[model samples]
Target: MSTTTVTSTPNPSVFGQSVTYTATVTGITAGTPPWGDVTFVIAGGPTIGPVTLTQTGVDSGTASVTDSSLAVGSHLVTANFVNSSDPLDNSSGTTIQLVNQAATTTTVTFVPPAPVCGETVTLTAHVAAVPPGSGVPTGTVTFIISADGPTVTGTLDPSGNASVTVPALSVGTHQVAAFYNGDANFAASNSPLTPLAINPASSTTTLTTSPPRRSAVSR
Candidate 1:
């Protein structure tokens, strides 16, 4: 009988990237030889050519195909040896390929770095995909203050930025963070806490005098 083994290069492939699948066929009987063409197919994907294999050993042959149009996700690849002289000797094998979404990063910034109590502060969240990826990040970003202070949400714009003005914050140091909910092409990410200082609001005093009015009345 004959046995087939299948393998893929770049096991963890990225979307729209090229990948190569190889199939090897070997005969179980020492004197028997496995020859002919091998057909490769990807489950829910494109079907490769039925390439002829070259015999290297007693009954061993190998074939390969390269494809780049597979969609992003897990796919089952199969290789079939259908040219064996005996129908029972024909063998097939299967392997798996994983396609991952693009990586992303999130960042948060404060317009004024430092603010005063009872003053409005602007918070901006920037979401960006790592290199080798296409398109900007979409969806919303949730901004929250450490120590469970407050939470604000903003939708990302075309430029992958979201901004919101927060109400007055208490006087002290605060750690602000942003979370990206992610989209179809990018993964979710969280930004590091950004420290912001809020100083106490200043106070004003007033003074009044009635000496001139009192002197005129007495005269």
Candidate 2:
């Protein structure tokens, strides 16, 4: 009965911290077919990070590693049992353990600055905005158009505001803009009636208002 085991990957705790590691073997063959000894080794991470543990020993051995000594980021670790201990059985990849972890990217900023109607808007990308208890959006997203939509692109600003420019539009209501954050969030722009229209001079007043005609009677 060969030994099989699974070790949980160590967390980096804070970014850029590595620590020593040791795995607890579960099942072992003890003494069976072609028995001599077993060697353990570490692998993954980076050269100065998880790359591999420095501890080496017989079969069913625990690897030594310092995870805090590694940089903050994602890492994949594996423990392998080499045939060094057993001379009769020469092989690799027979016994191995694997695990994965993420340090978590932290840099919360607002993404795609809030979209506006009929105005050029610039958007930035981020995981947080408004801070603590304020503006915070959810999930991955993209922008688009619906009706009389403005120009939108993937390019985002520091605040993740996509730029959209809308030129002068005709009079009448309109959904001048559409926000396609990958989500169908209908941001609307309604053109209010042009505030002041040239009220045509009343015909009754126009004729009388015209330059006083030299009276033919006076001529």
- Give the top-scoring candidate (lDDT): 1
Location of the lowest summed lDDT over 10 successive residues in candidate 1: 210-219
Clashing pairs in 1: none
lDDT of 2 by residue, 1-219 (tens): 334232433332333223444433322354322232323344434322222222233434433444432222344444443334444333322222222222111121222223223333332223223211122223342333334534433433444343333343333333222232321111112111212111222235444456767856753
lDDT measured at residue 155 in model 1 versus the true structure, 0 to 100: 98
Query: Residue-wise lDDT of candidate 1 within 105-206, one digit each (tens)?
Result: 899998777789989899999998775544577899999986636899999999999999998888998999999998765788999988988899999999
Per-residue lDDT, model 1, residue 157, is 97
**CA lDDT of 151 in candidate 2?**
41
Instruction: Quantify all predictions' global Cα lDDT against the true fold.
Output: 0.84, 0.32
